[model samples]
Target: MASERDYFHLSGPLHLTHVKWDNLYHRKSVAASLVQGVYVQEKDRQEQRKGPNALAFPWWAFFHFQLLHTLVDDVDNSIFGAIYEFKPPPSKCNDTLHKTPRYVIAFRGTIKKPDSISRDIELDLQFIRNGLHQTSRSNIAIEAVRNMVASVGGSNLWLAGHSLGSCMTLLAGKDMAKNGILIESFLFNPPYASAPIERIRSKKLKHRLRIASSVVKAGLAIAMKDKKSSSFDSLSAWIPCLFVNPSDYICSEYVGYFEHRRKMEEIGAGSIEKVATQNSVISLMMSAFGKESEPLHLIPSATLAVNFTPSRNFKEAHGIHQWWKPDLCLQSKLYKY
Candidate 1:
């Protein structure tokens, strides 16, 4: 099992930028400049830790081959997504240690707009069992990632996203893995495929809907297992790590489902198992139905439940302040894990 410190360290690199969907296009120039600054700072920061026994950051995985590309929807030429590729460095420990460039693809969270990525998230939630519609923004993100990978000779990949982007990260990872690409995905406060039923306003309706949702979720889980596709859920190397605030309704609370816990454990993500349990209504239903279940996303390799110090502002903690805090403009120390 991993402690909070391990998660904090693993989370260091991703903290380079705050991820939000629509804001991604609008803040491109600023984010690029910020990444450059972080690159320089990282070099100096690593040098300070240099000693015979000191661990080093994967600079080659992040800075040396840093290439940012913008993707657009072919239909309307709307900004589809942005991806960062890190071409493998020539050598590290020894001259012969070859490496493949790792791609860091991020998706943005939902925005309250009629024509934004949030709409796609809602659609994904509506059809959690089937996943996003082909023309949904989430699916478009998958196409963008696939195209980027193909252009680079189909190298190994890494993924990170915030909020709805986090959900997109899972979908893209699965699609890429099905195509024979290995990946490591990191998600920050990822939501369940379906929206929370706590807001339904009627307990009876909520319970019935929960049962309905559970049946649909279980059926989909069984179907996926039957297909035996090379989705991320079925890949050994496709490790995923999730970071969430303890009180986050979208992720933290939802992990209670037996299916969600089973998915995490199946991937050997023992770190998250501590916080997850088998008591959720969905898990109970799956057992009663005699169907094995799995989560909407791959079980993470590790789950970091962060409880920010000093202040526990719900919205603030739920955001990716662990990386970059836009409201405070504060950046934490970067670590190489």
Candidate 2:
């Protein structure tokens, strides 16, 4: 079974091109102009050969708190400015964890803009599935991969994304599974998933005053369960492996603001509108001018954890947000493949 440490521990660049399979892949590529929605391919190699495994972390994941810069169809906004591309390591990574090469692709596109709802249905499954929508990132992502895989062909593919990306990742998985496409694994963290199940106690990761008994019960379940039974079972031991954070206040307050704003139709109450405005500035500027990427560094914090505050400006907040927690000791967990 794969451990949380396995994924949470990886610190470095990951390519987003992993989601597409080889037979469906045709071009050698990496890197996208965040300012420009266009992606630039790596020099095509004569012999199209990929390493035993690959992981693609797009610009959005690599350049967090950055910008969103992409324009397509009728969708236009400043929510997608800081996207960047990842380069896979050369030479095959031959090892045990490399159990069938895995490729992860993250989409940095945004569907929910403060101004537009044109693509809302396609962006938010809820708009069509449950509520109005989750985010436009998912729809944009699915289309991107369909186009990408149609152009590249090398090997099997595995898709992974967080937040809004989770739905996109699931979409890819379901489609591939149904079509019998090659897929390795999916690495998702605190998906921005929208469903009736998400609102239940079973889905909430928050700690509470009344849940002490529940937490104790959860811990006991972990102790009694056989760790080797199944992946989900072994992992459930850490149920509510809660991250009571000092920084939680900001998130908590922010959630309230949005909930209020949404209910009252008052977008001006919280600093969210201000922040979103600033973010839009960044996105617009970035879309017009691409930026350079610094070395990737993983920062661990509850802001990156599940159900963080400030639902806008960012998609998924967990994953590599805080890659160095003690319980989240990733040193031994990463590099399985």
Candidate 3:
């Protein structure tokens, strides 16, 4: 069993490119003026030659986000995400290479704009309540991935998102799976909609409520299981890679657990589980009471957990740039190549 920590081990050229893609958010010059939706620096090419792996910038992901920026006059309104195509480039170590590309869809964390923040909140609610087609933005992402895949048949897909975007990525995976398209997800600091702890007055009261809620969750899970079983076999095909910071309040209770578990079980497959060490007891108690745990922090067992030590500055810890720090992403084996 590969622990979440094992997934981030950076070694080959492909992993190095991922680190660069993570940092692409900071290079506004590059992100804004993309050559066919992606920019490749000289350094990026140099890193490719250092190892036997070959990779390409996903113009599909970058161009779509760039389109979002154009549609909305405010930069803050941008829903940030980009797709990176990972593969082995032509090299002596890898002479015969298949052209099939593994598409990685990455979403940005929270930004400073008020509208963007509000947009995230809106999308979160829709995701929790109505599922995938609830928001136009999510629809756009799904359609984009679908079209890209259709254009290039037999392409393996991956999803990555941070903060609110994590929610989007997870939902996209669900929808993609429903369409019989399998995808792998990499989520960061995703928040879940949990029952308000303040609502529970005492442990005794909480215990009673837990029993009642268990019935409801079980019923709902069963209903969801039945509903999804007809459509898809196993969510295990959609491998979930989760990253989290223990101290971050935004991800105290990961919500992606129940839904994913049901999906995976539909096909008699198992892999989903929590990866974050922080909020374990809290999440357990919440689950006992049938409340949703943290969002992406604590999900299905199959979830590859990559835990991070948060910064003292709470805001910095949750910021997208903070997670991309070399000390964090570069420490672990990022790709299996």
Candidate 4:
């Protein structure tokens, strides 16, 4: 697999110092840059065999942010996430937007390198099984997020992650949101652990399949009604920004997910859709087998941004680099409760 550096060259100096923090594109660029920084830091650890050096820290500086902490997986000693404190220049300090976060926590996705691949893949499997929250690395992340929120408050912090790391941030963000703490979040190419129904070319056939799936899921949800919780409804007020590419099968399901809900509502099946959307087939199956699980992809609300620009391949489609590009063709919509 090609490294992030191979996909997008960052050897040259970055020119984002003057970008406004309140702008949507710039916020995405900054979030993606921070996540990329974690990837570079991991690569540096693997190549240097010593630890991450000064070179691995340049990504944050480009956005006028100082690295505050690195969240490492104890088993692999890989850099999976980092906390950054915004430190604008004296001239730009007063101009910074009030909504700008004082601190941002960003997480990197899977790296296929020998140093981190094993643990990263393990987390991926756990994610698929909806058991990621049971992992030690996840516990570590939750603790870090909890401590940060307690210290700085949720409004002053932001959460950003890509791919598997997006799953991590989603879990953390959901956990915090459940406790009435709403943090700004950016999720890039977050994995949706289900069939790639969005990739089906036949819209009619796809809609039929979705309706069938919804019926089954809704039935299962009703069957387990005694175990149901309205806690997830509380998350309706916390809307995260979800960046997805239609060509990226990993995250493309989100497009269909939101669209399916709208379709169901149009047909007056909104009640069934509500139960179906809250529960997934896999999660219901797990529950039947006496395994408690929460589908990681289920969210109450999001600002879903779909990239319409063509991708050369799956790598390009799913890459974090695309979000920072200036010429992206995107269609964004706010999906609320």
Summing lDDT over every window of 10 consecutive residues in candidate 2, give the lowest-scoring window: 293-302
Clashes of each: 2, 39, 25, 0
Model 1, global lDDT: 0.46
CA lDDT, every model vs. true structure: 0.46, 0.29, 0.43, 0.87
By TM-score, the best candidate is 4
Q: Judge candidate 4 at residue 140 and give its lDDT.
A: 87
* Every candidate's CA RMSD: 13.4, 18.4, 12.2, 2.2
Q: 1-337, model 2: which lDDT tens digit per residue?
A: 2222223125322433233323111011111112111111110011221242212222233323122223233354323212222333443332422333223354332233334334434554342222222345435555555554564521433344333333444454443433444333222242322122223343233223213322343344344331212322222112111121112331222222223224223434223222221121222232334432110010111122223333223222333333222233221111000
lDDT of 3 by residue, 213-302 (tens): 444544544433323233334443555555555455566333223433343345443222111111233434445566554322222233
Error of 1 at 77 (Å): 6.3
- lDDT winner, 3 or 4: 4
Of the candidates shown, which would achieve the greatest lDDT relative to the real structure? 4
